[model samples]
Target: MTADMLIFFIFVLSIFLGFELISKVPSMLHTPLMSGTNAIHGIILLGGMLVLASAEGFIQHVAGFIAVVLGSANVFGGFMVTDRMLQMFKRKK
Candidate 1:
């Protein structure tokens, strides 16, 4: 198989493994784990934004722009949800 196809297969396999592992976690751990993942997603969003800013040419620019938008949406939305969840645990003091 070609290198690209091999890489794609590995990516898919990793995603499948990730889901399987996550599924095995205790229910109470899900929120914390998801919060961490959202933080990582925010980092990805920043990277996407950087790429969009530095991209050259129309096609690359367009692709980068799309990536930035999608990533930013994920980052913002994830953080919002995480914040809301965390608030539930806050003390009233």
Candidate 2:
């Protein structure tokens, strides 16, 4: 198989693996798990940047831009939710 095909297979496998792993976690652990995954979303943002950098057409540029924006929103929103959850544990002055 070609390298691209191999990578695509790996990517598909990881998506399924990730979904199964997350689905099995207890509800109480979901927030922490989501917070952890936010970092992985940052890696997605990097990938989007690389795609944008190498983009060769208007459609590619638009798609890359959209990917980067979505990744950014996911990372930011996840952290915001996590921070709010953490604050719930703090003692108010």
Candidate 3:
């Protein structure tokens, strides 16, 4: 298989693996997991920006831009979820 096909296959495998791992986590651990994943998303956003900066072709630029946008959304959404989870534990006024 070509390099692009191999990368696509790996991406698909990672999606399945991530889904299985997340599905097995207990609810009690989800908040902590979300925080961790937020950090990961930050890293992904940085990587995407770096890739976009170095991208040459129109397709690569578009793909890199999409990756950066999605990564940024994930990071922000994760933080929002984490904040909401923390709020649930705060004593009511």
Q: Name the top TM-score candidate.
A: 2
lDDT of 2 by residue, 18-73 (tens): 88876778786677767867746666788888999999889999999999998887
Q: What is the TM-score of each predicted model, taking all chains together?
A: 0.57, 0.60, 0.59
Q: lDDT for model 3, on a 0 to 1 scale?
A: 0.84
Model 1, span 1-93: residue lDDT tens: 999999999999989998887777778668867886876667777878888889999998999988988888788887788788867868877
In what order do the candidates fall by TM-score, top score first? 2, 3, 1
- Per-residue lDDT tens digits for candidate 3, residues 1-93, read 999999999999999999988787878777778786775656688889999999999999999999999888878877877777777768866
The models' CA-based lDDT, in order, is 0.82, 0.82, 0.84
**RMSD in Å for model 1:** 4.8
Q: Please identify model 1 stretches exceeding 4 Å from their true place.
A: 1-27, 91-93
C-alpha RMSD between model 2 and the true structure: 4.6
In candidate 2, stretches whose alpha carbon ends up further than 4 angstroms from where it belongs are 1-29
